[model samples]
Target: MSLYRPHKKGTTPSGYRGTVVARERDFTAPTVQLLNPAGVLRPTPEAEPYLPLVEALPDTTLEQFYRDMAISRRIDIAGANLQRQGQLALWVPSHGQEAAQVGSARAARAQDHIFPSYREHIVGMIRGLDPVNILSLLRGATLGGWNPAENGNFHLYTLVLASQTLHATGYAMGIQFDGSVGTGDPETDAAVLVYYGDGSTSQGDANEALVFASSYQTPQVFFIQNNQWAISVPVSRQSRSPLSLRGSGFGMPGVRIDGNDVLVSYAVTRQSLEEARSGAGPSLIEAVTYRMGAHTTADDPTKYRTDAEVAYWAERDPITRYRTWLEGRGASPAFFDEVDAEAADVAADLRRRALSLTAPTREKIFAHVYSEPHPLMAEELAWLDAYESGFEGGAA
Candidate 1:
């Protein structure tokens, strides 16, 4: 017998008992949280074990985590500048969600695969992708900077919202098939972490992925960075409730962490990933944060959002809060200066690479369009060659 109790002993609830069953189109979900806006740690009973892990990390490590967020923010800003200067076609900024990306990225094991949305450039850096290569892709010089398999399992950024969730699920299924999980070996048991935004929660692909993950018990974590505004649309317009409850509907535990709190984000993601790798199936993390800057260079958030709302979130800047916490712990001023200098150096190098990038040759674009050359491709290539040869300068 099922453990669930009926809403009524022998009849439906009063509101629906005598009426036809009408499907209500609206429902609200609750946001699960382990930390508050303040820097104080406040973990739930279920999340208590993870607290020790966070506390065990040394002060130096915590400072370095802050540095990662700062450096990444600098890179994001520089990329936006590049776009404005016509060095890039477009640029997506992760200005406010740095803690969410860096904390989770640092928590990932070397064997873990990360499927990310386009805003996860910081995560790419954590996975060993050079910042300049990522800039090159944005500048239209390459499809992507590094191969997925070579970059410590960091996959290419998915431009389509929520599509990478299914890819991550499928990859986790392969991991399960290969018996790469549940061997009690942290070094070998692989897990997958997929990143998305709150706006993507409404996508059919995201919901379907949750269904498949629950049914198959894949070792994956769905990391949703709820940055409040989905481009110009406020999250309230998309759903009345929090996004974490979506995981509960699919029969997996859901937790929310302060995405702005690096400590909480790292601790919770680390714990959830470990659980999944140990055969705990999939989990969902709804990270509560804000996007302080425009979604992209092409977007003007001022049209859709109030200046007051933007100012409010600015006061709670993730990098600033972490720096404050580090200062309280006696971090040296020299260390901060060193990190700032290093970030400047990285940004300068990226700018140089972006300006010097050469466009790929015409032939290079067609070379990988197919695995094996087809008759149609041959004919198209011949036509292009003949057409180009008609010009004063023939095809190179």
Candidate 2:
């Protein structure tokens, strides 16, 4: 029998049992969309001012956007496969949210800092992180861990939901304290961009971060990728109000955008970060998008959502819609073909590398416990060694 099936009647309210999706509230926030579902280059009225930003982009940069999305999907696929094949402990797929990740990631200036809630693999890769590091983490082989300074200021992922909001806010405050923001010099000025999910909005840490971020007028942008469902729970069940309003509630401007539209994501984030770095204070952006896959390798989305809903989103796949726009731009078939070939290569290489990663040593766990060595850690390591040495032919 299948482990996860749709709920019939008379079951409990939870995954693997039954669900009661009380969509008592619906969010109908107006969103800025530069590209429609048909891949047309028409912008909504709200997106008019930002049209020039997209137009001003060189063809090469535009092409890079598509490349990044394509490659991210390939790597995401590889991650899922690795998890299923028992090569990875778990996998968090960013399957359907490519445009939002790519566009927003590209919008940040080199001087800015970013904090990602796990699942933003592409965002880290864009900030000069090797995808192998991500795979290594999943493969249970990370030792010292990645350094943000060496990786374009992209901080490591915080697995705790909504915790990164505070981390990002704290960093922004540090930037302010150092007089790195509002200096009127774009090159020297910096800001913070933090990514969180729709569900995280309900977390106390997220709201508290907002409180501090707004009160201090921190140089930061709160980018909420509202992908409809926060894990298996719908956003409507959590809040009747539009998430964009969250900005206004916190004394900041809130803007909603079509997260699937790369143009909208890039233009709006670029403008928000600019204003932030220039000392205009913080802002909130609600990127309305969807996660077309299971929440994680362990999840079964089919158990909670319907087939029709999946079909509807599949029609609006970010990669497919973006490719349509690129085609309208007269991109050659060879360019697309080359991208596909490269994506295939990337996926294959990731699988090969992921399999090669060895497990981390026990000593590595104690190494990062503190900046300076601790006597307790040394004693514990010795105890662990003696305990393991009791086993036959053990290195301990």
Candidate 3:
């Protein structure tokens, strides 16, 4: 019998003796897709409404989108190389999840806010964040590169896993209170897109964020990148069902997309964000992708995973797949070559900037500790100066 077949009620199977094997029901989830891995346009009937949005995107813009993924991947690879060479303090590789990050980020409007986990550098890049600024955060030069208020509403990368989910929900609630959404003007209305990983789904904060989002019907989208492995633990260890199903339990619609397929990711995120901005409640999107490299520079995948697994994911590299799709769609070879060159140039510049970064001075840390200066901060600075003066160099 098939493992997924239903068991008869009150009847035991031959292998179980007296116990019965529970039925495995198929998942009934709504996934809005526009493109498959082979670059074919086989959209579902439900996805038809969003075709105009997809077709409206210019070919030049699509080429740029390809460039974004390519450059981001190059930067990620360089960062990994730096980590291996003992330059960076730590590096989180978003190797195989570029399509999900880049596509979803591009789908958001300028007014929308984004809350990201630490590995969303690609999203930050799409929001016009300086590459060097992002490096400063990884190198421990600053808490985060730019203020959210001035950086296209993109919040700082939260290292505490799913903590950003609550932050996003709170921001969404504030948006509702301020009457910034459901204004019928897509350009002016605001929404929230918060990103997390499969590992963070197990956190209490993530669950609570979903609860509050549902209760208030906030205009937000919870973007979960289910990269198969949460550090050393496989996703199977976290839950038996897909992560998107968690949204159903919270009374919200959920979607699953091929995260490695950039077109699908962009199309689905665009639809979801538009729905949220147009008075719909929160939605959860689970992007099924993989992390082809180690979780972080400090991690050793060899200890917990097999080489065959890494090689398996490598074959499905997001950048490569997207490039193949673009090429198949009559994209010129010259365009591909130009993008490759541009990516290389960007990587070179980033490497130079990272290597030439200067460490902040002693007083620099105290500059932004508080908006207004306080006596306690003055006292602390004075003490730090005295403590440093006691060293052999008598300087910090």
Candidate 4:
């Protein structure tokens, strides 16, 4: 017999359900989903107001959203395969969160600055950074690739949990000081979007960043992609209520959205970002998505999570649902075939680029840390050189 009692057919699973704000057509309750899982373009009560924005998107842009999400998923899968094949030192998979990443990323305008919390590969790609730029880091070729200023204002990936939140806040403050926010010029005025995970919310740096953002009224959005797992720790163990409520305590508005629905993600993020840019202060978004894979190539999800949980999320696959909606809207099979072909080409290119990457030299690590020579660094370099000289393959 099953240990747990099953809920009704339309209700969410026990642990995943939140306070019902409003019911959808299917009678389920949880985060906001503009498009239902069945691929119908049904807007929830919270998302109804944004229907015009969603409808305003040109057909080409809507198609691009699907293409971008498809390509990103391919890139993520390729990254994992490369790691398993020993081509990459480690890989962070954003498997089921493509809708969350791509939707919010596509919402940003060119002048908007983005700060990513390591796994936002799709976001980085949307901001014009080469996908290989991220792979190069995982391949141990460089600390980071692509200059943020030149590469569409997308910052380097921050692996240290929640540290990027502070960096993003500081940058947003600078944007404010420079009279960028609320300038009434969309082209010149800028806002910042920073991503972190649910686990990062518990970090002091993230809370501190929120305090500063609220205090200074910085034009920014703190996007928390609550993927339900902090390494091996479930979000239920970390917080009592929704992660979104944490921002409200800091005087910033917070909204929890169904991260699996691309439409809601795009609309909400676009709305939040616009509010921030217009000097309405910062906003927080808790995207309720599932990781759908091991946290990284080094992790083993089977050890902590159950197969049933995985299967549950699998049924709500963002790509498949979006494809259904697109088809219902008269999207041709030829278009999907073309997207598939493009995804294949992107995967091939990524594989080629990843394999081509060369590991950084030992001495190169000593550079970039300090602007001027320091005694401790010099001594360390000397020690490294002397230590290496003892090996048969030591460099001169």
Best by TM-score: 2
- The clash tally of candidate 2 reads 0
Q: Residues 228-247, candidate 1: write the lDDT tens digits.
A: 98898888876676777778
Candidate 3, number of clashes: 0
Off by over 4 Å in 3: 1-33, 44-49, 390-393
Measure candidate 2: CA RMSD. Answer: 9.6
Candidate 3 residue lDDT tens string, 104-146:
9999999999999988888988887877887888888888788
- Across 1-396, the per-residue lDDT of candidate 2 in tens digits comes to 977776657664363565567865654667899999899989999999999999999999999999999999999889999999998888999988999999999999999999998889999989999888888877778732599999989898888899999999999999999999988997999999999999999999999999999999999999999888877899887678889989998899999999999989999999999999999999999998899998989999888899999899888888899999999989999999999999999889878877887777889867868999899999999999899899999885
- What lDDT would candidate 1 get against the real structure? 0.85
Prediction-by-prediction clash tally: 2, 0, 0, 0
Candidate RMSDs in Å, in order, are 6.3, 9.6, 6.0, 9.3
lDDT (10s digit) by residue, model 4, range 17-76? 556777443322247778888888988787888788888999898898899889988988
- Overall lDDT per candidate, in order of appearance: 0.85, 0.91, 0.86, 0.90
Q: Cα lDDT of model 3 overall?
A: 0.86
Regarding lDDT, does 1 or 2 come out ahead?
A: 2
Winner by lDDT: 2
- What's the TM for model 3? 0.90
* Candidate 1 residue pairs that clash: 29-241, 29-242
